[model samples]
Target chain A: MRIVLMGTGNTATVLGRLMKKCGHELLQVYGRTSSSASALASELETNFVSTPGDITDGADIYIIAVSDNAIANLAGELKLGNHLLVHTAGAVSKRVLQKASRNYGVLYPLQSLRKEMDDIPPIPFLVDGNTSEDLTLLYDFAKSISNQVAKADDELRLHYHLAAVLSNNFSNHLYTLAEEYCKAKQADFRLLLPLIQQLCLRMNRYSPSTLQTGPALRGDSATIELHLKLLEHMPGIKNLYTSITKSIQDHYRRTDN
Target chain B: MRIVLMGTGNTATVLGRLMKKCGHELLQVYGRTSSSASALASELETNFVSTPGDITDGADIYIIAVSDNAIANLAGELKLGNHLLVHTAGAVSKRVLQKASRNYGVLYPLQSLRKEMDDIPPIPFLVDGNTSEDLTLLYDFAKSISNQVAKADDELRLHYHLAAVLSNNFSNHLYTLAEEYCKAKQADFRLLLPLIQQLCLRMNRYSPSTLQTGPALRGDSATIELHLKLLEHMPGIKNLYTSITKSIQDHYRRTDN
Candidate 1:
């Protein structure tokens, strides 16, 4: 498939490389920054364009992997033909690309992708298109690169994006909190790595709810009080401890969770 | 090494099974609940005890894998010799076992442990004792099962526990939120499972700080405001989203993260 990839950012770089490696022809790579765009273009052996107008019309699909805010404006400026156009965004809507072309769709990869991600685990692409035929084409293209592909609409995709934020972005911050607490205690951060990994692995065997343990979940208010007292030295961590403890208590109080 | 495993709960069952599999002698499997104790005893082909008084005296190490509040009481109640008394808790200090004997220590496994864990990954065991010799014995016993064992003090172990709460408990709650969001959208939660798994797998390649992404971390108040407005209809979710968003923003603003 001839693909004109958009943007030279994290998602674009990773996706473009994977697509090219999967035997898809890279028509062009577009970005405002020539440093990244040109470098990525050189690597993919494709044209590097800084402007949306510079994108040619020979490509089968236009994958816009730009930031969410810049997406609508960029699509409005692009001179896309009836060629299938897709934006790799979690929050942005597909209708934003309608002005650019009738063959518009979404190819949202529900993962917090990074350039340093070496072995990109099997990504699940949530796809949508203007028509049934276009949807089939997008699905096939996504499946060629990933075994995990699903057809999702605007509302469902937006919902998944929220969930992604909670699981990926918020969860990573939680890990950071753990690192901070460990550092304060003159403890090695690696001590908690095994536990973090095990928590994820346990999902394969049982629901996280069933596996939940600790003072808050166990309803040991005595231990909870002790922990809160211990957190007095760190004001910010103390607040977080109190908030999470309250939330856990509220959950159990209402539903016996 | 002859081991008398007490408490046939999640931790006890896993540890006992692991120790036996590693060619250690399992002298007995005891628990407060008769059904659980009897079941584990039958599985290990060992004696079962409903009380700590039924302890197989003179065992190399007596590990009290009970709740924090119960540890001190249980140790006091147990009519056993000093030998080496160890309580598996991060928050509870080594001093908690003072009633048992002078030969006391802690053998806390730093992982989200449970009996149903399919493949118990190499979990790090944080160990400490009242004396150098006791610490060595505890460390050696921990090392017998897991290669990832470390000598940790109570102060450090408490920090480890705090980190565990953030990484394990807090992260799982985020997952719960994601599941809740999925239900609201009438979308199958399985669609996001692959994405969640990949996020975890990527940890090997990138530190979370380097991979942080979202409206909150990106400093895009525009998208965040939009999300907040949309979430206003859902009071519970809206509050959660607000707190987490504030937490992330505060984190990045301070760390320049």
Candidate 2:
């Protein structure tokens, strides 16, 4: 597949490299800035264009890996001439690319990607297309670079995007908050690393509900009170701690009853 | 060290087996219930004592791994005759065991433990003793079973325990809620597995604050509004979604400013 990569951010750079590694011909890299476009294109050993008008129409498929807000605007500028045009975004609908080409779809990578990462993690692509043939084509193309590819329509993709926010973004925030708490208390945050890793390992075999273990789950009000007292000075953390604990208790109480 | 293990729950069972494997002499296993005591003793190839009076005074260290509420009661019953006694609890103060022995401390394992787990994950032991000498002894003993050992007083242990709850328990609840959301929406929760594992891997090298990426962090109100609308039917998840999103926004806003 001859691919023209749009955008110069994390997703674009990582996905562009991945496509090249998997034997896809990256025809050109496009970025709003010339330096970024040139840098990424040099990395991919491909030509690049700074302007949307300069983007070549020679590629078999055009992948827009730009920010969610820019997808629609960039789609309107691209001239795909009925060639497959896909946008790699979770929140945006596939119809956003309707005017870009006769063959349009979505190729959402469901993993957190960073361009500077030395080892690319496993990417699970969530592909959707305007038609059955386009869907199958996008699926097959996704399969070339990843072992995990699933077809998700706009609604389902939005659901997953929300879930990703909860599981990945929200959980990582908890970690960030915990690290801050540890630092403030002069407790070695590194001590929590083993437990964090253990939870990840346990998730593979057991449901998170069954794996839940804490003062909240045990309904140990004594420890809960103590923790609250400890965090009395830090109102933000205290609020989060209180709300999450209440949520956990509420969840289990409802489920158990 | 000749050890007497108390309680028959997850922590007691795992720590008992670890102690035995690390060449510590298990003198006895004690539990309020005869069956539970016998079961754990048999597993450790040690003697069982249902009553506290039957507990021998020969052990160098008596490890009480009972529930938090039961710690004080169990400690009152035990007669360690000035032997090194410790309770494996993060919240409870070391003073709870003052009556049980002249030398008492905490041997709180910072990792989540389950007796039924096939593999025992790395347990970072946070130890505290009544005296400097006792602290050193407890530290060395913990080091025998775990490579990660740190001396944390009651306050620091409590802080880490709180941190553990936030990072492990709360984050896990997010995973649980996300899994439920996926199940309801007919989305594959398993697809989030790679992303989840990647976050854990990234945590080892990067601060979670630096790794945060999503609608909330990006301040993408359009996607956030769409998500909130989609979650309107599920009030519980919707409330959580709203609270966490606001928290994320508030956090980054403060940090960036």
**Best candidate, TM-score-wise?**
2
Error of 1 at B163 (Å): 1.4
Q: What is the lDDT of residue B87 in candidate 1?
A: 86
Angstrom error of the Cα, residue A90, model 1: value is: 1.2
lDDT of each: 0.80, 0.91
Clashing pairs in 2: none
On a 0 to 100 scale, what is the lDDT of residue B71 in model 2? Answer: 95
Per-residue lDDT over A1-257 for candidate 1, one digit per residue giving the tens place of the 0 to 100 score? 99999898889988987898799999899988888889989988888998777888888999999888889988989877698999999888899999999899999987767776666666889999989999999999999998889899887788877777777888887777767777677877776776777777667656655666777888877767777777888766677777776776676576554
Off by over 4 Å in 2: none
Q: What is the Cα-based lDDT of residue B115 in candidate 2? A: 96
Question: Which numbered prediction scores highest in DockQ against the true structure?
Answer: 2
